[model samples]
Target: MQSSSFLAAILFFISAAFASDSVHKYQPDDAVDLWVNKVGPFRNPQETYNYYSLPFCHPSGDAAHKRRGLGEVLGGNELIDSQIDIKFQKPVGKTTICEIELDEAQVMQFKEAIDRDYLFEFFMDDLPLWGYVGDFHSKRKGDNQHMLFTHKSITVKYNKNHIIEVRLTQQNPKPLEVGRKLDMTYSVRWIPTNITFARRFDVYLDYPFFESQIHWFSIYNSLMMMFLAGLVSTILMRTLRNDYAKYAREDDDLETLERDASEESGWKLVHGDVFRTPFSIALLSALVGTGAQLAMLILLVILFAPVGMLYIGRGAIVTTFIVCYAFTSFISGYVSGGMYSQHGGKNWIKSMILTASLFPFMCFGIGFILNTVAIFYGSLAAIPFGTMVVVFVIWAFVSFPLALLGSVVGRNWSGAPNNPCRIKTIPRPIPEKNWYLKPSVVSIVGGLLPFGSVSIEMYFVFTSFWNYRVYYTYGFMLLIFLILLIVTVCVTIIGTYFLLNVENYHWQWTSFCSAASTSVYVFLYSIYYYCMKTTMSGFFQTSFYFGHTLMFCLGLGILCGATGYLGSNLFVRRIYRNIKCD
Candidate 1:
């Protein structure tokens, strides 16, 4: 038995050595370049030329394409040397071999996409081909040693004229998982590669129904807005007419006047302190200013998206956003500082600083955490250190200073008006509120109408961001945005009216919070989408996704809150100024 065991071990060792020799580890003398073409969905059955290549794995050909200028790309002009060339191609008879290394995070991303069975259609020189990435496999060579690699095959055929046609076919559709290695290696090959494809291109349109759905949603949202607006207008007119009529009937008898004063009810009673500066006016102003800036930013981006001006490059929208935000810093400062001064605030500088930095700080802090995680995971998605430094410089010098300048100008530009109502020296006792009338209840309920107006459209936006679907329906988005604003204003006004009728003078913050609650629903919907719709896994993707979502929700909150406050402010001022109060 011992002799037999020794012979078996020796035989196993020899076999292991032979098996290991068959597969050699790849070593490239120069940088390995992989070309990633435009990614599209399989369901879209068009000719597939409309998809633009992603810039992450840009090749030498892109440089030449950009040199032709934006007009050539945007104006439907001639194709300007945009095809990526495969320089490493060998003789048609010999199999071409190359090693591609992917970071662990990237592998995880690919795995997530593949696990969902997303078929990305690829285009080469206008020839459309489709494929899905498969699982990573490890084969035991011998002696407990294993070789790891992912396999994919692309078949090509050559005609009599040597014109080549490439066909993409799935070899093994196994689910992929990230291994222990920080970088995963894959061996790719073109099997039976007859030869190259002669240059010919065609344009294909897909997702035709996507545009139609946007139009339908826009109309639905507009109808909802109109309903809410009409309801609020009717209620406000009736209530205001009654209040004015009652006030118009003067009670000249001193005893009757005293009784009426003692029994005073409705908004007229709180007129003395309704416009009194809310607690922490600085923070309130800052929020309003930030909200205004974000609202404008969103509107401008939506307007420009369909025009193809903002999406110039892979990161061009981000760059445009940053630059525009910096320039728009003045709007935040001016709005916040002006409103604060008008409300008799003393700390204009504090309000301005908070206006400029509060939202940005939240965004940066979350981004830093996400970027750090990406870096630790060896993901190329992380922003480079130098780029972060440049961003800081721009924020500090450009955005911050412009905000300060705007604040100074606003503070100096004085045209103070006498307050519509005189504040009483002693504070009136607030009545005990019912459970349903509490601020918390009001806020949650007030957000519903506004949220409902955009909920359907929000799904598409989320899917576009995470599911990698191309979104190009800005016209519909713009209409939805307007409808959302309308709903927010009308709902907030109704809520403010109720609070005032109850003699609650603290409508300033409540008005903002109530409308801003739409963001809360938005965040909740995002959580639901992540749990139910997406196949994304891994700690890095989760953290990045939530962090960004939080920032987005916060921006939405700001925009809605600001819109509510401005609308309420106008309504309150106009009504109070017109009323005759003794």
Candidate 2:
């Protein structure tokens, strides 16, 4: 019965999610509802507050509010019915909404909002309309005056019965002064259009900007890099084959073999030490596992987004991401457990705990800081306590248990060590090499190609998130992601080979860091983007921008690091498999 009840609940949620996307058809003279969504400064996209937060006239007695979905609520949307009367095909002209008696406090509030360039958002038939709260005027005396717009003109376009577009214009600006009687008025006009409902969102998409020549050129450049990487891999494979032939020859006499052994000065000499356990094996395993899970999570989202049209809904992407991350926690635990065991780690509990909590705790810490800032500023960006509790419950009940189960299964199934060569009891001392051959140098230089592969796409992504541009190019994103993975793997393998050639057995962390350094370049590029592209100001906006970028870079680092380490691991194993350790 319990299992049945759980299944029913899952089905109900799925149905609800899909139901939100259902098309709405209307009849003539049907009542139309206007929803007041949010208000915020135009410069900062994430800094938002409830529409009713300002000193505006409230609806009389038990105003109706829209019931939001999980994603909508998480997105800081608190939509309330504006209680304005309208008909689907009918128009209303020059109607008064309310009369406001502007006292000292009301005048001050309007002045502050106007100074900040605040804008309000309203929704009619799921179509959005934005208008400024007020305006600032400069006099000949060089003094600025704040003025409030007391009139709203709404124009709605429709195709047959479906709403295609909604526009709002604010007018009738009056100086903000005490003892003023301000009359708030509104007018609604309905126009017919030939546009289909499917194409209603076309106006919001910046096609020319997204599909610019530079975007295509970046894809071409990445393709060229991939070809170069493939060439490098071919050359490396040939060299390894020659080395194997020389080392595996059985016809050579004892003296000849001894001479060859003495002459062997490269990667072959470090075979026994290459597979030795790395420092903090538990932590490394946990990071790699978490990275694997994140990689899979991103891939799944990219695949699902286009089909589901996730971009059309408010906060849908974030909701999908959270759900996918929870379910995918099992992958992290399995990978971490198997890796830790293979490294001969004894404390399974520590590995499991780290694997489960490392990424979550990191995000929570960052979120705590951001949330505190939001609360202090009284912005809607601050997540509510109820929402936080729901997230926690999902993680604790669903994610944690699945991860624990996966760890136990992985330990039992694939935990045994399978290194090509046996580890020696005595540790091998790494000799001094050229400055370029040093691990630090290799790690820093190795990330250049990988960063170049995805830098162009990063601009588009940043614009979508920060500049309020709608992102509908999931196909392009999918291609860039594949290119990044390929480039990271090839670059890290080459870096690992160089490290081994210098008789360095500690290539494990070096390879990971080599690929992970791509995030450093990305973060630096974000700083450039913030300065050159955006007009955003104030301490709150700056903190949120850097904080969010930091979190993104950390995830990207983990994903790239894991991809590089796994690829290098395969290369090392395959090369050593043919040559005898004995």
Candidate 3:
């Protein structure tokens, strides 16, 4: 009797596993619907696209009228085209959710599909925004490839002239188990009037990533900032007290000066030539100019992001970046020209040209290579030709002339008191340094501290970029950015003081290198992130990842390098100005 009972229980469970389908019919009162396409990882199986839905659903009513803009001339809009509708049999059962079958001619559109590793995206008001998600990995035994399926319950209806309308109810408690029937229903009393789905997407999907796990990162960065601040403060106080006493005695009398002359060591000895401009002054000036421009752009972006100025629409932030960068060209030329002239550079025109060309040349050269790869792969991520032309036009007409005008103004007021001590015609012999005091050793060690301060936050940034997730916590990001700047400047100042103590006065590049080497750490961390954190694969993904990152690092190197150099220069000037150097 016990054995019979066990057999009956097993039969009951099996019957429950294969339950019958329960279809939820489409309702007219539903506010909005998004029909999902085949879902897969960044690297999907070739057949996945062949089987996914063709270009069926598009704007039919008022939506097409509203989404039109001047940018529509660039020609990526599919909603503007006549609707190509095809009819297929009504999906039969719950098993029908497992596949979306399209014929050969219909499948040709899929052939030219952009190779985005995204799992799912839907068109809202003719703009494709990422929100939908689905299981891509095959479940069948012995099958080793990504599979496509309907993640949510979808209801289909045929309209006039082959147009098809879909009412898609989101799947609840996702990744439905193999055994049970999957049925879902979504209700809306009124339709969403927003042109883009960004707002709704942010509320539903993006908020969780930003809010969760940020507390730990915040705590870590805050502690680092406090530690660095305290360390710098202590050093500043001790150094100032000692230096003041010695300099005060020097100005008192000949007897007091003679007694303290032998004891005068470290940075005081280098005061005579501390402000003497180093070689490649023009390039250094340009770097500093460009860095300042970028720093301002970043600062404004961070401040604006929290205020929602740059967060309103698709590509708004990018547009802000481009426009701000262009307008900031004058600042770059003005600063570079002023610094160069102070350092005894004669040709103001050359300084302007160098400052204006440095950033754009590097950016466009690297960008073109990466964009070519994107285009070859049919990726929508590639910048359009028209957009590139617009960028170029902005650079040529607005930015270049502004740079020239600023340079002319900078040269007019370039006669600032740059040197604390008069430059001697003959060069002073720089004393040889110990092993730890060498340039290479100092640079490597200098960057590590700053890198540590920002390392935790960088993980989230990379995840947002590579994983196609949303990043909305600009407030936290802004705090971390401030901390990073503080840490970089402080660490560079400390390193500069030490290098000067070792009798090495060539600090222009060393100070820059000391801070800029943080980019090396960032790049290495990116490699580690790629290997461990992401599942992306393919030649295009690999090429784009490393190539684009290299440029990013280069830009950061310039920014941090300039920041560190400027801080060190300020410290050096301040210390030398108060000293009694004969």
Q: Which of the predicted structures, 2 or 3, would earn the higher lDDT when compared with the native?
A: 2
The local lDDT score (0 to 100) that residue 39 gets in candidate 3 is 32
RMSD of each: 15.2, 4.5, 14.4
Off by over 4 Å in 2: 1-23, 138-143, 249-254, 260-263
- Model 3 lDDT tens row, 1-582: 999999999997764343211112223222222333333345422112211233433335533222422232222222232222212222423322223234455334333332343344444322243423333344569653322233344444322111133344544432323333333222222222433322333433366676676746665766666597668868875987787786676678878767866665677677766777888888998898888777887888788775764553445566667778888888878878878888988766777899998988998898898778767756544567767788889899988888877777776786365687887777667877689998788998888877887788888778776665556768777877777778888888888888888778888889989989989999999999989887767776688778768888887888888888888888888887777767
Q: Give the alpha carbon lDDT tens digit for every residue of 343-372 in model 1.
A: 888877678788889988988988888777
Q: Once model 3 is optimally superposed onto the true structure by TM-score, how far is the C-alpha of residue 211 displaced, in angstroms? A: 2.2
Tell me how far candidate 2 lies from the true structure as C-alpha RMSD in angstroms: 4.5
Clash number for candidate 3? 1
Q: Give the best candidate by lDDT.
A: 2
Give the clash count for each candidate.
0, 0, 1
- Estimate TM-scores for all models: 0.72, 0.93, 0.75
Name the better of 2 and 3 by TM-score.
2
lDDT of each: 0.65, 0.88, 0.64
Ranking by TM-score: 2, 3, 1
